[model samples]
Target: MGLNIGTITDACQWECVNTGTITDAYQWEFVNTGTITDAYQWEFVNTGTITDACQWEFVNTGHDL
Candidate 1:
């Protein structure tokens, strides 16, 4: 249960595709709860599971204030 990008203004591209098997893997932050300051706007690609499946990922630059 992740992927909760709560604040991202424009220049956006989000994709989280899961096709089979995903119990729990919590570690997603591209502005997950609050505050965002210049982290290339927004770009996340969680291709199911914990990490790396189809590539295109970036979920941590600096924010939560």
Candidate 2:
């Protein structure tokens, strides 16, 4: 049951400039043979930079097989 990105249920697109601000910082596993892969090291930003800087991740959640 491995997901390889293209099999996702939803897809979206956007734009950005500063894409390096986001980073992967953590990970974990559950008792039900499930895993958690943290993607975005920094999830918060100022309102001033929200429009100008569009840092993003190639993924969000409900993933990691």
Candidate 3:
């Protein structure tokens, strides 16, 4: 089975679990592939102006999935 989020439009929350044999899924990400939005974008303080800054890097090499 699979989950298809192709029809979702509004804000919502969802979760997924792995039942396959990928036991070493120790890394995941929340990559924003869209334009700079307020709720999910990073900014810096320069001249009191906020703009789209560099993306944050996250990694967990020692944790198990």
Candidate 4:
């Protein structure tokens, strides 16, 4: 089946990145738009609080988490 865009929200404090790790604080409080996993913690939106166009280019490519 085709997977659609999904959203994610971490209960604990976390920062979304392209990959995940023990050192990677589990604070990925983000809206998972697709196949996001524990290894994908380096794809966080580091654009600060300036919500606007081009603010969603923080995927860091298809790199491993």
Candidate 5:
């Protein structure tokens, strides 16, 4: 139903190649270092935090949030 991520360390790296839908509900934070590559639809509800040090590359051609 939802995803709850308490904290993300500085060493954390994420590579997401989504072709469908990625949905997250509630609060979360993406901090320090990371990479997010979204291709299709990505949806997020509620509030969240993203630090300036985190790298996000979204190649979304469709609907995204």
Candidate 6:
């Protein structure tokens, strides 16, 4: 799966679980917390106060062909 964000503000929490890719291109401000859990690959781009606390977890169960 894939995801993108142009602007995120005052977000209390965010969670992402994917087997493909994720991207955030633009601005994230005043975000309280966030989490990303991927099995393959992901990307985060752009700037601004993303969050006060952010967590990322990656788990590889197998190989990608």
Mind giving the per-residue lDDT tens digits that candidate 1 earns over 1-65?
Answer: 33544445432444344544654334433323345444333345455556543343555545443
Residue 36 of model 5 has an lDDT of: 33
For each candidate, give its TM-score against the true structure: 0.21, 0.17, 0.21, 0.25, 0.20, 0.22
Candidate 2 lDDT score at position 29 = 11
**Runs in model 4 with CA error above 4 Å?**
1-28, 33-42, 50-57
Candidate ranking under lDDT, highest first, comes to 1, 4, 6, 5, 2, 3
lDDT of 3 by residue, 1-65 (tens): 22322222221222223344433222212233333223322221122212211222222233222
Off by over 4 Å in 6: 11-13, 20-54, 57-65
Candidate that scores best on TM-score = 4
lDDT: worst 10-residue window of model 5: 1-10
Which lDDT tens digits does candidate 4 get at residues 1-65?
01113322332233233333323223333444444445433444434433321332344345444
Q: What is the lDDT of candidate 3?
A: 0.26
lDDT for each of the candidates?
0.43, 0.28, 0.26, 0.35, 0.30, 0.31
Q: 4 or 5: which has the higher TM-score?
A: 4
lDDT of 6 by residue, 1-65 (tens): 22423222222343433332333322322221345343233233323332322343222324431
Give the top-scoring candidate (lDDT): 1
- Provide backbone clash counts, one per model: 0, 0, 0, 19, 0, 0
User: Candidate 4 local accuracy as lDDT?
Assistant: 0.35
Ordered by TM-score, highest first, the candidates read 4, 6, 1, 3, 5, 2
Identify the runs in model 1 with alpha carbons over 4 angstroms from their true place: 1-12, 26-58, 61-65
Q: Which runs of model 2 end up more than 4 angstroms from their true locations?
A: 1-13, 16-48, 63-65
- Tell me how many residue pairs clash in candidate 3: 0
Record all residue pairs in model 3 with backbone atoms less than 3 Å apart, i.e. clashing: none
